[model samples]
Target: MGTLEDLTDALARDVIAAMDEIGDDRFFEKVSKLLLDMSPTTQEAYMTAIRVRLAERRARKYVEDALHAARAAKAKAPE
Candidate 1:
């Protein structure tokens, strides 16, 4: 059997992809509940992985938006 980390990470990625494909934002919560029934430790690890990935995605978007705005402002400024 794979380590807990590997299993949890893989599950997290698969759950995210499934959620995207199904267009259900609450899918993670459902999966978390299911995992809890099976194993609380696994559920917690999966939740942590999901949260970290989602947070990173949000952080990246913020950085991208800021960069775009900075470039637009620079373009508009006097040369």
Candidate 2:
């Protein structure tokens, strides 16, 4: 099985590819907004964990954004 780092790299690549395919500035803007909305304490905790170098915070951000989008899409879909 792949390690967490390997999985993170794969996810990051997927996110980048998805962004490239969509070619929409709003997609990124939405992600930025989400990041901004995160609590300062949460952000600080993430930064501290990432500073250890064992974790990839960027990958976490990508996954968080993707999950947010997925939830939004599901909410919008017909029940």
Candidate 3:
């Protein structure tokens, strides 16, 4: 990625970390609004990064839950 892309991704990571630290789920939306007044391109990139990261986290959770359920079922099943 180029400088802007790198910077945008870094900022996105910081935003996510801050949201988790502060216990405010809508923090990114507030950041997005601020970015709107600054640079539309950067704002879009930041939003995209946020969306992708959130999606990945959700997907990972789904996979982990499924695995746990499968292991539990196996343990309960008769040999």
Candidate 4:
């Protein structure tokens, strides 16, 4: 079994790979342009929504790291 750090790093790499497959920078640029073109109120709402979504994604990654740590600890524990 992999160490917790190793598993976490692998998962992060996988996430980056998936994002790359989806054209991450292009998506960000598009969203940024859309946000810039919106009215102030609309831009505020859109930015808030984007921030929430990003926070959720970060939270999910944190959970994944925690799970990996738990699994590694369990494996290393003596019977």
lDDT of 4 at 51: 55
User: Any runs in candidate 4 off by more than 4 Å, and if so which?
Assistant: 1-21
- Model 3 clash count equals 0
TM-score of each: 0.87, 0.33, 0.92, 0.57
Instruction: Write the residue-wise lDDT of candidate 2 on 1-79 in tens digits.
Output: 3454454444444445566799853353354345448655433443333343324646788899999999999999999
Q: lDDT tens string, model 3, 1-79?
A: 9887888789888998999999998899999999989999989998988998888988999999999999999999999
lDDT (Cα) of model 3: 0.92
lDDT of each: 0.92, 0.53, 0.92, 0.59
For 1-76, candidate 4 gives per-residue lDDT tens digits of 3354454344444544565798683354355466568555444544455555557879999999999999999999
Q: Write the per-residue lDDT of candidate 1 for residues 29-69, one digit (tens) a residue.
A: 99999999999999999999999888888899999999999
The residue-level lDDT of candidate 4 at 41 comes to 49
Question: Clash totals for all models, in order?
Answer: 0, 0, 0, 0
Error of 3 at 1 (Å): 0.9
Model 3 stretches astray by more than 4 angstroms: none
Worst 10 residues of 2 by lDDT: 45-54
Better of 2 and 3 by TM-score: 3
When summed lDDT is taken over every stretch of 10 residues in candidate 1, the lowest stretch is 1-10
Per-residue error (Å), model 4, residue 12: 22
